[model samples]
Target chain A: MLFDVQGTATDFFTTVTSDAVRIDLGRNPGLNWDDFVNRWRVAYFAAVAATPTPAGTWTSVHSIYRRTLDALLDEAGVEYPDTDREELTLAWQRLIPWPDTVQGLRRLGVRYTLATLSNADVSAVVNLSKRGGLQWDAIFTAEMVGAFKPDPATYSTAARYLGLPHSEIMMVASHKYDIRAAAALGFQTAFVARPLEFGPAAEADTEYDDAFDLNASDFLDLADQLDA
Target chain B: MLFDVQGTATDFFTTVTSDAVRIDLGRNPGLNWDDFVNRWRVAYFAAVAATPTPAGTWTSVHSIYRRTLDALLDEAGVEYPDTDREELTLAWQRLIPWPDTVQGLRRLGVRYTLATLSNADVSAVVNLSKRGGLQWDAIFTAEMVGAFKPDPATYSTAARYLGLPHSEIMMVASHKYDIRAAAALGFQTAFVARPLEFGPAAEADTEYDDAFDLNASDFLDLADQLDA
Candidate 1:
């Protein structure tokens, strides 16, 4: 099984926002970090969207976050210390796991080979998995594949390395677009819903679709459905 | 830390030899299967040695083993069944780990990130690690790097993916050639002494080389020296 790490397994939103609030809130009480973090996530999404898959130079997701954060801070006129900026960028490497992430992974790991197929840089994925106490059969990243997720090359590259056909492998993610891309390439898709991925105020798409091979509310539910 | 999985952490010679004896001894009581397995290992080394590190079409270690086995059986006029040959080839993927492997990995894991840097296919490494109940922070293989061990590209590619400099990484291996290549690239080298690597009848090198950063009798010794 290939897992999408960002929103599916780890709570990057809460982790990054908490780090931001802890580091900067005392100095700027009026600054709404929730909105700032939302903007940061949106900027990251845009940066990745603009970058093409392979055939040219590849920009790492780490660089994109660092670069975009600088641009965002400049626009907001927030003259943060250079150290703080670096620390916040490093925060992406140690995102907190969702409540059921560890337990579910432990359960599913017994019957299935679990691996990370993330758009994050290989280092970031390794650090995140290690920090979260997650044991993966192997760690794969866009950096290794030379393309981010949603690219056919990314999914195909993972399948090739695994010595498994796309039809036999399952792609698990909380995002519909990721599963949709995998499905297009003949991979079995499991859509795991993370209701607070974008925070409590935002409405997440927790809908079940027959189009996907499996649908569940969280990773534990995913494990139960898979009978792992 | 990067590790050579075959002889350093696992006893491939014993595992393969035992599997061969179990499957073929009854059929051919006159066959010296131990010598045959040794010859098989030597052929594997020669095959990888002939292949270029990069710029050529890369062949996986698994493919090399399978091909060489067929050639060996043909040369020996063994007339082995195709199914038996396939099963023998699969033996390399589930080699038994050294007695100190899993426990030492568990201990060192608390203080450092542990990963495999072996000349095995990604799937083989994954299967071996999972089956052995060995938890690595990451599983890296020659297939992922496009080169076998002793090639500078193999070590450098791992460093590139890890976002770590060569000086900070330690290459642990029973084979001198592997650690030598890693050391040439500025990586710290740890020579692990596996006295019975070739079997009880063979004299294996268990020497202490000052050229390497450290030398240990086993994984547990290495862990203790590293204070992990």
Candidate 2:
């Protein structure tokens, strides 16, 4: 099972928001940290989507996130210092896993191999998984493949390295676009809903979609559905 | 900490020999499984040593091992069936971990980020590590980098993906050549002597060389030496 890590397993909003608030505690107070984090997420999505796919021209997700953070801060007319900006950007490397994330992975891991196929840089995935106590049998990241998810090269390269046909590999993700891309490449798809992914106030698409091969409320439900 | 997984962490000798014995129990009974495994290891070393390092021309260790297995079996005049030959070759994917491998890694992991930097194919390393219950924060395999160990690309590429300065990353291995290659690239070196890596009768080097940054008898001793 290949996991889409950012929002599906780890709660990036909480981590980025918490770090923003902590960094801006006395220096840059009254800024809506939550909104800032949400925008940061959206900006990150836009940055990756806009990135070109050819191998040598690829920029790492870490560089893109840092650049996005700087642009947003500059646009908001905030004077968050360089160190704090870096720390906040690095917050992506320590995102906390959801309550059921670890247990559910442990359950599913018994019957299947688990790995990350994320747009995040290799270091970010490694550090985040280490910090979150997320045990994966292997890890595949955009840094190694030189392309972000939704780019066919990302999934195709990982499939090559895994030495497994696309049919045997299931893409388990919370986002429809991610699973859809994997499904396009003949990969089995499992959609796990993270209703509060964007935040408590934001409405995330939580309804089960029959387009995916399987759908579940969360990882635990996914494990149960797969009988793992 | 970057580990050389095959002999340093996992007992490839015992695993391969046991599989060979089981596969050749009724037929080819007189063949010395111990000698066969040692010769296989030697041949694997020679095969990887001969491989060129340019990216696209590189071959996976899995292919090398499988080819080497076929050659050795054919030379021995043993009529090992294709299925048994394939199964025996797959034994490399299920190598058993050394006694202190798991416990020592667990201890060292608290203070350091542990990862595998192996000559093995990604799938083989992943499968063996999973079966052995050996936990690593990240995995860096030769197959991903398009070169085997002792080639500068292998070490440099892994260090790049790790996002760490070569000075800060320590390469830990049982073989001096492996650590020496890492040391040449400015990585700190740790030598863990595996006395039985070849087999009980073999004169495996268990000597401590001051040339390495540190040397220990086993993973536990290495952990203790590093105060992990």
Candidate 3:
């Protein structure tokens, strides 16, 4: 089974926001950290949307994160040193897993080969997996494929590396778009619901969808339902 | 650290020979199994040497094993069924690991990311790793890179995936040719001595080369010296 790490396995939103709170450089307690974090994520989404064509030169997720962070900090009037920005951006690599993530993955790993097929850069994913104590049979990334998720080449590249047909490999992610794209390409799809991926106050779309091969509330639920 | 899996981590010679012994369809006891195994290894080497250009059509190691087995059996005047040939060819994916491999890799993993940079097919390496209890942060192989080891692209592809410079990532292998090739490309080289890689009766090379960045008797010794 191949997993998408950012939201499905680990809570990047909480982790990055907490780091912003801890390293409050120019922020007053009156400042709404949640709103600021939400804006930062919005900017990230916009940046990804504006990414160059897959055939263009490679731009790492680390570089995108750094650029997005600089733009967000400037807009928030939060002055920060260059070194602080680098550390804060790197928080993505050290995000903590959800309560059920590790155990669920361990159980599933006993029955199936577990791997990470993430948009995160390969080095970042490697660090994240090691930090989160996740054991993957293999780790694949957009950097290796030279294209981000939802790109046909990205899914096809992973299928090629795993030496499996698209029909045989399962793509598990919290995002519907990711699952939809994989499904269109004949890959098996599992939709994992991470209700608070944006934040605690945000209303997440956690409803089950019939289009997905499997809809799960979390990793544990998914593993149990799969009889792993 | 990137590792060479076939000989450095697992004893493929013993594994394949034992599999042959178990499925003795047309074997004569007087026929030396060690000699037959060495011939198989030589055929594998020739097959790799004769591999088509990286950009050519994909050729899996498993397919190469079956082809070579057919030729070897024919030469030895041994008749085997197609089913038996397929089963024996898959023994490459179920090789046993060296005694110190697992522990040494575990210790080193605490400090540095561990990955495989093998000539084997990616799926085969993944299966071998899972079966042998080898814990790797990432799995890379010739199939992923579209070229075998000693190919400049193979080493460069691994460095690209790791998002590290050639100098920062170390290439650990038992084969001198692999080390020399990687060293020329500026990768840190570690020569791990596996005395019985060919077989118990074969005089395998285990010399410590001063040219290499580090040379040790085994994975554990290499780990100890690296202070990982």
Superposed model 3: Cα runs more than 4 Å off: A26-31, A53-56, B26-31
After superposition, the stretches of candidate 1 with alpha carbons farther than 4 Å from their true spots are A53-56, B53-56
Interface RMSD, in order shown: 0.7, 0.9, 1.1
lDDT for position A15 in model 2: 86
How far does residue A95 in candidate 2 sit from its true spot (Å)? 0.6
Per-residue lDDT over A1-228 for candidate 1, one digit per residue giving the tens place of the 0 to 100 score: 999998899998899989998878577776777778778988999999898764436688988999999998888888889998999999899899999999999999999999999999889989988889987899988887777888898999899888899999999999999999999999999999999988887777889999999999888999999999
Off by over 4 Å in 2: none
Give the alpha carbon lDDT tens digit for every residue of A10-109 in model 2.
9998888888888888676767777888899999999899988775555878889999999999988899778988888999999999989999999999
Q: Cα deviation of B121 in candidate 3 (Å)?
A: 0.8
In terms of TM-score, how similar is model 2 to the real structure?
Answer: 0.97
**Model 2: TM-score, first chain:** 0.97
TM agreement with the true structure for every prediction: 0.98, 0.97, 0.94
User: What are the candidates' individual DockQ scores?
Assistant: 0.87, 0.77, 0.76
* TM-score ranking, high to low: 1, 2, 3
